[model samples]
Target: MRGDTSNYRDLFLGDVPMMDARAPIEFRKGAFPHTVNLPLMTDSERQKVGTCYTQQGEAAAIALGHRLVSGQVKAERLAAWADFARAHPDGYLYCFRGGLRSQIVQTWLREEAGIAYPRVIGGYKALRGFLLDTLDRALAECGFVVLGGMTGTGKTDVLAQLAHGLDLEGHAHHRGSSFGKRVTGQPAQIDFENGLAVDILKKRHAGHAHFVVEDEGQAIGACSVPVGLHQGMQRYPLVWLEDSFENRVRRILRDYVVNLGAEFVAEHGHEQGQLLFAQRLRQSLDKIQKRLGGLRHQQLAAIMDAALAEQARGGGVEGHRAWIEALLTSYYDPMYRHQRESKAGRIVFSGDEAAVLEYLRRASTMARRPDPGTSA
Candidate 1:
C-alpha cells in the first residue's frame, strides 16, 4: 500500500484473504472475491462522518469519526482485525480507495496488535480497474465465437465441453433464463466482472483462441455484461446448436425441475424446498404471463399445480413435461425464433449437439496452430 499501487497479483493470483475496511452496506453492494468486511467504522458511524464531511469539512469528519469510534467500540474492531491478521498473516486490508479508513486500520493493527501489513495500494477501485482493462484487452485481441440455440438446446452444455469455452452463465450463477435464479444469491457486479476477467485471462494465457461463449442477454440475472464483451459476442462468429423438441423437453426437465428441485431440497429442507421450487416455477410462468396470453397462462398454471402435487407426494417430475411443452411451444420457442430471425445472418454453423462439439473442437485446434510462413 505504501510503495506500489499496481501489483494486483497479491490479492487475485492466489487464495489470499482480504480484510475490507469499508462499511457493511458498501461491502454488500460490491466487493472483491475473498474480502471479509471488517470496517473501521460502523454504518451509522460512517453515515455520521459523511454528514460531518458534507456539513463541515474533511477535518470535522475525521474528528467526528475518531470521537464516535473510541474506547470499547474501537477496541472491539481492533481485536477483530487482530484476529483476522493472526489467521491470515499474508493477508492485506483495503478500503474504497486505500485512503484514510484503510490507513487508520493499518496504523491501529501495527501499533495496537503489532501486525504491520500492506493494504491494497489503490484498493478496490484499482483492482477493479485492472480487471476491466483485462476484459477490454481480451475483447480487442482474442477471437470470439458465440454459441447460440433455442432455450433447451443445451448450448451451455456444449460450451462447457470445449477447451475454448467461457461459461458466462456459470460465472454469473444464472442460466440466462426467466427461472434461472440460483438457491444462493448471485455475486455482486464487481465480483461478477472480476471472475469473468480472471477466466478470460487464464484461457488467454494458456494460448487458447476463440473464447467460446453462449448466447445471453446484456444482463444475466442482477449483473450486466461489459459493453466490450457483449458487443464482441454480438459480432463474433455464431454456432447454433439445434435439437429435437422432445430432446429439449427432457433436457429442461432434467435441468430446471429434477436437478434444481433436488438442490433446493438439499439446501432448504423438504417441505419448504418443495414449496420454493413450485413457487419459482409458478413465478417464472407469471413473469411472462402477458406473452403467454390469458388462456395459455391459466392452462400452464393448472399443469404446474398438478406437477407440484405429484412432486410433493415424493414422485418423479415427469408431470412437469406438460407445462414445459406449453412453455416451449407457446413462450420460449416463439421468443427464440424471433431473436434467431434477427441474428440469422450471423450464424456460421448450425447443427445438432454432437456436430457442434466436433466443429468447436476442430475450430479450436485450427485457431491455436501457428502459420507455417510466420513460424520461427
Candidate 2:
C-alpha cells in the first residue's frame, strides 16, 4: 500500500518507467508509453491456466499456473524483474487490473528478492482509461485548429514549430498518404490512441488550452484517430497551407526520393536498401493504379522506372521530378482541391508556410491570454 499508486497523471507526465506483468498476449494488445512487457506468464502458460480456470475454477487455475511457472522458469522471470527494478528504482509495475498476478509479483519481489517495487493501483486498464478520458476532455474543453493543404505543402513542419501543435501524423508515424508508410511498421491501434492522449495530457498540464493538428482523415496509414477527436476536428477552424506547384514537386522528390533513399540505405545495406526502396515506390504507385487510370498509371510507372534506374547508376535525383510532377498534377492536387472546397466554411486563414506558422503562433498566444471580462 505504501508504494502502490493510482496517480496516472503524474505517472505519465513524469515519464515514469513501468514493468507490465500481464501475459504476453495481453501486453501485445495494448500498453502505455515507456512501459515494458515483463509478462507474468508466457502465452502458452497463460492459455493452460485459462483453460484450467474455465473448467476447474480459480483454485485449480492457480495450481496450474504455479506448476507451469515454478523452478527455473520462475527464477528467470524474477531475475528479469529484479534487473528492471534495480535499473529503475522509481518505476512501477502492473498487470491487467492490479489484481492477483501483480500482487503475486509484488509479493515475490518483497519476499524473495527483498525489493519493494511499487505497483500501479488499477494497472494497465486504469492508465489506458485515463488517457482516453484525457483526449475526450481536451476535445471538449480546448480549442483546436486544423492545418489543411495539398500533399507536401509542409503542414507537419509548421505544426512542429507551435507550442500546442499535435502532430497526429508523427504519433501515427506516417505522412498520411498512400506513400506514407515508413520502413518501420506503425504502432498497434491502442498504442496510437494512448500516445495521442498522453500528448494532449502533457500539453494541457503545461497550460496549453488550444492545439493545432493537420487536416487528416479518419485514418493515417494503419492508425485511426479516435472517433470523438476525429469528429471534433471536423468542426474546428481550418488553415489552408499553400505553395507553388514546382516547390511542392521538389519537396516531394526530396522527401520521397532523396531522403527516403537515404533512409533505406541507412536501414539496410546499400544494395538491398536501394532495391527495396525502388520496390516500395513501384508498389505504392501500383496501389493507386485504378485511381490513376490505365494510361496515366502506365505513363507514370514508366517514368518512375526510368528514375529509379538512373538513380541506381549514381545519377542525381532530378529524374524523380518528372513522375512526382505528373502524379501531383494528375492525382493529388485535384483530390485536395475538392476536400478544401467541401470544408471551405471552416477555413479561417490561408497562406504559404511562413505566414501560416506566424498566424497559428499568434492565435495560440491569443488563446492563452486571460479574458479581460473575467476577474483578476
Please name the candidate that would achieve the greatest lDDT relative to the true structure.
2
Candidate 2 per-residue lDDT, tens place, 266-325, comes to: 999899999999999999999899999999999999999999999999857899999998
lDDT of 2: 0.89
Please list all clashing residue pairs in model 2, or write none if there are none: none
TM-score, one value per model: 0.91, 0.96
**Candidate 1 on 142-258: residue-level lDDT in tens?**
688889899899988888888789898888998788889877888888788888876765566556756789888899998898788887777888889999999999999999999
RMSD of each: 3.7, 2.9
Each prediction's whole-model lDDT (CA): 0.84, 0.89
* Clash pairs (backbone) in predicted model 1: none
Among these predictions, the greatest TM-score belongs to 2
Error of 2 at 188 (Å): 0.2
Error of 1 at 267 (Å): 2.7
lDDT of residue 307 for candidate 2: 93
